[model samples]
Target: MGELAVRIEGLTHRYPEQNADQRALDAVDIRVRAGIITGLAGPDGAGKTTLMRIMAGLLKPTMGEVEVVGLAPIRDANALHLKVGYMPQKFGLYEDLTVMENLVLYADLRGVVGRERTDQFERLLDFTDLHRFTGRLAGKLSGGMKQKLGLACTLVGKPELLLLDEPGVGVDPISRRDLWGMVQSLAEGGMAVVWATAYLDEAERCDSLCLMSDGHVIFSGEPAEQIERMRGRCVHVRDISGNRRHFLRRALGSAQVVDGVIQGDNVRLVLKEGVERLDRALLAKEPDATVEPVEPRLEDAFIDLVGGGPDGRSVLAETTPEVRIGEGVDRKAVISARELTRRFGDFTATDQVSFDVREGEIFGLLGPNGAGKSTTFRMMCGLLRPTSGDAHVMGIDLKRSAGRARQKLGYMAQKFSLYSNLSVEQNLKFFSGIYGLKGQAQDRKIAQMAESFDLGRYARVTAGELPLGFKQRLALACALMHEPPLLFLDEPTSGVDPVTRREFWMHINALVDKGVTVMVTTHFMDEAEYCDRIGLIYRGRMIAAGPPDELKKQAADADTPDPTFEEAFIELIHRDDEARRKTEAAA
Candidate 1:
């Protein structure tokens, strides 16, 4: 190693407020060196964040050696703070303050108030590309810009070692790439950077990785080595006809299949170890099925380490009846938006958006942060009224009667919008009541939801206190309580681990198989691949709409032959941005 930036041995930490002797980190050992980026990755409650805090001297480890820059973490914390830059999961940015104001405040807090401060501020402003938006309120910036601002604030003191906790949690792919680029540049400058993330793809970008689970370091080395172990085991299954979802369901259910994810028009399957090759028995029924080997990804290796998720089945669909369209509803266009427009003050949030979501299909409204997909989603879900145009759910005009349309819709907000103080059971009961469920029906639905999501053990636990996976389950259960024919999910799997993500999609695909329509908005480009069709929005306009494969075709250029979903998303967004710039120049 070049130089040890952080060193820990037999580190153990337990919160004074935690119930029992449950340690956040137990007998953990990790190291970070200068001039490289080290990734900290794991599922929720895996202690990645705890280790980061301890390294930054925010928490004193109960036992073991903890050193940063060759200095003790707790004994020399005052001096250590000057050499370290730590950004918690929730960066403390004053939303109402301007970008420059926030930067100035952070600089003052770091005692950088002089000519040196001015020079540092200018350098960081250019580094972060926030000069033009210096006067903009932090709250008014997009998710990406806010992250840049947060990074700029953290760099106020010019620290040598930087600790970032889940910096790309809700950021778009492009912004995430940009943020990573900045961090990479810092690493090149010999600053030790540690990035903790839930996204496996991000972990792959690091120079080295330390994968943790249950308060112990599972693997600490190059991510590629870990991924190499999963090679030759990854294969794609393609049906002669174009029913990838059905094939995915089957592949996931196979005895030999350990994990499967929908990729474009095929289902990528990871076979169990020692399986050598895909067995003909896997798709014996479909003689025309094609099986081709593909490269394994960090996610595949991650799933292998963490046990297999739900057994490729949705318990919620076990006892629920199949969705059936009632009278006066057009099955072809279960959800239709024509020239939809919504404005807030001087900004047009959704500008002349139009799309159609066919019955039994999972239609995604895909876009970057502040791209207006969520605004269009709100109009489509009847949560917000459009300034012009119209939206119809089940053929009912949203402009005329949104409340009536909502009776047939189940909506889940992007964040954990459910009551935090309420227990899981209480939230379920509240949502059931909100949907007008009553008496035996409400009781039966609650019981079914609890059992379906395997939330019986956590029924009495507060929604806010539950882990990330359990929170997703509770939110999904609440939205599904009424068993509406259409479900609207806003970033349903944000910040969740891969296993929980698989389970969530398994349930969604199962629901769609049963004829339920789904409309979703998500920042994850990979998750967008699972949608039947995508409405690609940018800057308050529907830039493109098609199946995931078709969208990739649209994104192909001279440089790329077959672009990944994230590449396609960025390409499409860049195209829109370039076209808009030309238009503005012409005007």
Candidate 2:
């Protein structure tokens, strides 16, 4: 094999306050080939970031040696900085600096002075597609654009090794695709890239994979190889009983199945030892039920390796909804929008978007970047004043009674920001006080939330110091402290590990069951299924609004093509493109 770009031997790291042997990374060993994207996948607290920091020379391993670019990260950080680009999970970019200004600052920091600055800045902006918005403040860019800028700044000195920690988290769909495209292009040009992400779908796209959990590599190889490991074990079973979900989950809880998740009206069961009797009973209960074997995916493998914990029961069954478009919307929606539009000078962010989020149901708002979904979401949340049209949260008009609307709504922003200097508990207290909660009531709420999110121990830790996944949970907890009637989650699970995302959704679904309305925007297509209704936004308009299956059916049209939501999205975009082309031709 060619000389390894990254080599770690007996790597172990732990905090002093942690248990003596509570190692974040346990005696781990790994070697990364140059010029390939190696994805690091694991759940919250699994030590993905710790390993990345070690590789980047930011953190000192408790024990072991790391050779990055033929030198140790600790002893050679200055020298290594010239050859390595490290983007931490949270790369705090200066919000006040314009995109171009931030890029120039980085270039200058890397010693790109005078005549060379112009060309380098232009090239970086062009590659990152930030050229058009060079004047936009770095803080003002969308989640995806900020990420791209972060990557661009990291590339200032032409680093040979690039370590990206969950780079695509919280980005929109099209923007995520664009970021991946850029990453692959960089890899093709001979840059060794280490991308850490919780999304297994994204991990499958990596050149190779290193599955890390508990700070250890459980599996490392092509994703296909990992899939092959669990071949013929995963089966998709349609559960006819409405109670099938509860039953399957309880059964799976006792380890009566290999693994199980709700997948669109079916229980995907992994047959394991001791679950034979239960499996037989399930088959007998639903004789006509379809149980076809499925090819294993990375997600299945992750669940398997992670071991079905108590939270496994909380794992979302990827169930296809039974209701048609608007059929199951019984409760009057808590939030409604009608032809909402927002503009900045000459740029129209949202044209005319209308949708309703049913009370006590999970609703999804999905779209590509620049499609005005965020604008629509902001209007609903009363964060921005709509230029025209009307929006309401629990019957309170957004423009007329923003404070009243805010009282009924809890919003988890795309970017998780709590007071960096404040401890987790302190941050929760601040949010509680904002909602006018006091003393015993606030203490009770914080205790319950801490237990649910498992944030009890970290209550004293600084909010900024929490891991990416925990940061998300803490932000979510802060949003839910008031227990509003409705919640607006903007890409809450974006860039989170599958396990962590699963855990996050579990609490959300639980609250919904207790009559909480949810409006969520996410790039993960699979997540769209969890919604009772979904609205597809494009070009500042609601192009399609319906349940997931109905939208898929409509996108399929009379041809009866086998089109998934993703396929439907592509077809819709294509149709839009064609319509524009025809209009231009007519003109």
Candidate 3:
């Protein structure tokens, strides 16, 4: 390895105000070398942030040895400040300031004055591809743009070591690839980087990784080596029970199966060790079903270590009534947005965008950050009225009877919109109460939700204190408490671990099987497989709309015979950009 950038031994940290038994980070040890990307990956509240803060000298540890670039973080705090750049989980970008102003302020704070400051500003602006949006306020910038700006601000003085915490959260795959390019280039230039993320793909790209769980470094090695641990236990499974979803649910419930995830028409299964046979026992009665052995991924390994996620069957699905299918069910359009247009001042957020979500199917609305997907979603949910055009829910006019129409729907916001001070049970009770449930029925619903989501243990705890995965479960439970026929999920799996995402989608799949209609928006491209049809929105326009296989087939050509969903998305966006360039040139 190259020269050591950070070295830790027997490090332990516990917040003074927190319970002494609850150690944020247990005895941990890890090393980071210069000129390589060292990924720190773990589930929510896995002590990644605590370790980063300790390395940054921002927080003093309760015990143990810590050294950054051969100097102690606390003892050489002043000197360490110039040698390291730390971007916390929530980057402290001044939301009101323009991109240029924020860059300048960060540079000034870093003491990069005079000609050096001006030169650095131009360099970072170009590096982040934010030169054109220099005048845009940080608050107004898209999620991807905000992440790039945060990286730029962190790179103000070119510190030897760069520490970033979840820098790619909420960013689309294309933008994430761009950010990876930037970080990889920096690493190649001999800058050591410690990136903390929940994304397994990101962890796989790292030169080496430190997989933490419960504040302990469970694994510290290359990604491939970690994946190799689960080599004999992985396989790709196909549906044999006629319905893929049903077969998958059966497979998950199988004793031999450990983890199962939907990956574009196929479910990848993580089988138990020594279970090489894929007979009728594992195939749910279809002995002839095709089962292909495949390479395991870092995600499978991560899920294994974190303890397998929730099983395939949903507890809530048992009691939740299905949306009754009538003779016209197949022809029914549960959610119809016709020429939906929403404008703010002189700027149009969604430009005559339209799509129809059929009954009992998952319709995905995908777009780059700030591409007006949220705007369209809010308008459809009756939270925001469109300037022109309109939406209909269950054939009811959203513009006119939004409240009455909304009664037939359930919504789970992207941010897990729960009262910070309310307990898990309390939040469930409150939402159910407002949705018209009362007395014993309300109480029964709350108990069911708590049990279904496996949140009974945290029922008394404040919602704010729950982990990211638990919070997601709680939010979903609250939404389904009403048992509405239609569900609206906004980035329901953003920033969650892979296992958690599967757990969530499993619940969703069960609901869909029960004839419920789902309209979801997510940044996770792999999730496109779960959608019956997807609408690709870019620059406030509906660019493409089709099933996942159709979209991928459309993007296929000479160089790539079968492009992945993400490649299809990028290719479509690239073509649109090229066309725009041509138009501008012609003008």
Question: What is the lDDT of every predicted structure here?
Answer: 0.89, 0.78, 0.88
Q: Worst ten-residue run, lDDT, model 3?
A: 323-332
TM-score for predicted model 1 compared with the true structure: 0.97
| Model 2 spans with C-alpha error above 4 angstroms | 92-95, 112-126, 134-136, 239-254, 258-280, 283-289, 309-330, 433-442, 555-564
Ranking by TM-score: 1, 3, 2
- What's the residue-level lDDT of 536 in candidate 1? 90
The lDDT leader among the candidates is: 1
Judged by TM-score, which candidate is best? 1
The TM-score, computed over Cα atoms with residue i paired to residue i, of candidate 3 is 0.95
Candidate 3 clash pair list: none
Segments in model 1 whose C-alpha atoms lie over 4 Å from true places: 16-21, 240-242, 584-587
User: How far in Å is the alpha carbon of 325 misplaced in model 3?
Assistant: 7.2
Q: What is the RMSD of candidate 3?
A: 2.1
Report the C-alpha lDDT of model 1 over 1-587, residue by residue, as the tens digit.
Answer: 45999889999888896757688888988889999999998888899988988898888888899889988888898999899999888899999999999999998888998899999999999999999999999999998899999999999889999999999978889899999999999999999999998889999999999998888888999999989999999998776374677777777777778898888787788998888887787677678878899999988898888866557777788777988897777888999999999999999999999888899999999888999988899999898999999899999999889999998888888877789999998999999998889999999999998888789988998998888778988999998888899999999988877887888898898898888999998888888989989999998999999999999999998899789999999999899889989999999
lDDT of 2 by residue, 136-197 (tens): 99888878899999999999878899999888777766677889999989888888889988
Cα lDDT of model 3 by residue, 295-409, tens digit = 8889889888877766788877888986764454334687898899999999999999998999889999998898899999998898999898979888778899999888888
Better of 2 and 3 by TM-score: 3
- Per-candidate count of clashing residue pairs (backbone under 3 Å): 0, 11, 0
